[model samples]
Structures are given as C-alpha cells and as structure tokens.
Target: MVYVKRALPPRKDNGQRGRVFIRRAPLNRKLRPKQLLSRFTVLWVNTAGVPFSTAGFTCRASSTGGTLLATANFDNFGTAIFNTIPTPTARTLVIRTFDADDNLFRTRTVRSGISAFAIIG
Candidate 1:
C-alpha cells in the first residue's frame, strides 16, 4: 500500500491553482523484479474547497533501474507519482527530470519491507 500526503496552496487570482498528482512509484534495486512502469492516473484535490482544472500537465514513471524518469514542465501545480515493483533485492532508483532542462534530478533507494497487506485489508 502506498500513500502520499501533501498540503497545497490556496487559489490565486489568475484562475490558476495547485494540484495533487500521483504516479507509479519506482523500484530502487537492480536485482529486484523487473516491472516496467508505463501508465499513471492523476486526480486533483482542493484543500481550500475550490475547483480547478486538470489540463496542461503530464506525469509518468519508468522502471529501467538506471533510466531517467521525467515529468512535464509544471508552472504552479504540485505533481506526485508512485511506483510498485517487487523488491527481490535492494536497489537504487533514480528519478530524473525534464521539467525545464533534460537532466538527472532525484534518486531514491528502495528495499524489501515486511508485508502489511493483512493490516490494510
């Protein structure tokens, strides 16, 4: 089970506002099970009880181990993506960026954890 909690800013005057984005989480280890992350589903939540648009944005993830994952250029909104891959072994996952310029941006390490499936269910 994966969950992301974020606090978005209030709406602005130019009809622009913040957004809550979600994508597949990436696996960190190299020896882990090979799972290719290709699709992402996104939803926008309003904390200030205001409506917003979900256009003009992109969010995605890839499981190439060392391959770079990039997101579209976001002006004012916040984007969040998640990945779920079997961790057969410990590995390092890199989260790259193409937001402004094509370059490597972020990286995270993932390791095997105790199964809490029963607790969540």
Candidate 2:
C-alpha cells in the first residue's frame, strides 16, 4: 500500500530546522448551507446513467438574491466538490451548466439544498 504527501504552503516560521506543521482553517458556520434534505453529494451523469466526464463542462450556482455561491468544474469522474459553498440568500438557487464551448447547456432553479444539478445528454 502507498500513501502520498503534499508539501504544505510555506508558513511565517518555515525553515525552523526541518520541522513543519499544518493548521486547518477554522470552520465557517455561515458558509454551511441549511440543508432541508440529507443530500451532501452531487454526481453529474449522462442520459445512459453514466458519469459524464467531458472537458470544459462546468456548473455555477448563485443565490436568487444575486450572490455568487459556487462555481465548480467537473472532474474526470464527473463529480464536483464545492469546497466553499455558502448559504444561499433564498431557498432556491439559480444553477447553470455550460458545455465545452462555453455555451449555456441548462438552467435549473433548484432548491438550495438539492443534491445535484446535472446536465445530461
């Protein structure tokens, strides 16, 4: 078995001999969306029920009150991790998906707590 390690970003007191440390960022309570459902995962898939992994495919979510919430790009597995999702101003979110050419693929007015906003083709 093998595990990988990554170099932590340099700190103010870096180079104190060879000792290093990583401090986790303090959790922001306000950033956590109030989920009406227990859905904490989003998976983008195609019409055939397969994960869609097309390049340049992306999703942008904004609050109905005109606040940008999250913009996530699809990964190789057609999964997007919203590392910094914040609570939306309204219960509904305006989520838009774009294609490889940067053209609008779909627009979905979904609940702020919806599991996924998918663009299947």
Candidate 3:
C-alpha cells in the first residue's frame, strides 16, 4: 500500500476552505491485486482542531480505475446555530482503507491546503 500528499492550491470557496483532496490508485497488479482492490473500503477523519459537521461527507469513486475522491465537511450541520456560525480552519485529511479481512491496508494524512466545509454548503 502507498500514500501520497499532493501540493494543491488552497481552495477559493469559503465552504471548502479546509478541504483535503485525495486520490487513491492501485500500486500494481502484484502489490495490489485486482481481487483485493475490489474488496477495499475507505474511511476518513479530520485530525485538525475543527470537527466535522453531523451532516456527514461525500465520496466519489471510479468504477474502472479503482480510484476515489473523499471530501470532509467543515460545517455541515443542519441546525440554525451551526448554519449561521461555521468553523473553518486548517484541517487534516486522514484516509484509511481496509481489505476484506478488515485489516488496515493503507493510511495517510494530509495537513496542508485543507479546509473544513460542508458538502452541501
């Protein structure tokens, strides 16, 4: 398994100020067999001081390449209080993938050029 942190420009949208972008791809046919890749599952978290909203997050995956894009929400709450006052900060993008056996196959964290914003916002 491998992890990579890309140097992307900071996001311009206020809702995505601390958004972290990640692209996951199979290393090779031998290292990451197609059978195992198909059974993989992804999970993420915010390691920075800010907390993700209860509204949840969104992820987009490619059917052919076995690649995925996961985004964390900074302020995704639906309540009135949280809607008006949002917490935007330098958040960390922690991505983890597990195999069929539930064994952790890969883990990575990106701290730069990230923001905490809601997927809907």
Give one digit per residue, the lDDT tens place, for model 3 in 3-104: 898899976776766788898666763553223221222223355433334343333222232444343232243211212212332234344434334455
Q: How high is the lDDT of residue 3 in model 3?
A: 83
State each model's CA lDDT, in order: 0.36, 0.66, 0.35
Please provide, for model 2 over 1-121, each residue's C-alpha lDDT reduced to its tens digit, 9 standing for 90 to 100: 8988989987685458787689765776345545653332346778888987756787777778878878888777777655565333336777777877889977777775455556565
Q: Output the lDDT of residue 64, model 1.
A: 48
lDDT of candidate 1 over 13-117, digit per residue (tens): 764457656875668735556444332222233666332333343333344455544443322433344334332323333333333344443333333331111
TM-score of each: 0.24, 0.52, 0.21
Top-lDDT structure, candidate number: 2
**Local distance difference test, candidate 1:** 0.36
Worst 10 residues of 3 by lDDT: 78-87
- Alpha carbon deviation, residue 110, candidate 3 (Å): 1.0
**What residue runs in model 2 are displaced by over 4 Å at the alpha carbon?**
1-41, 86-90, 115-119
Position 73, candidate 3: lDDT: 30
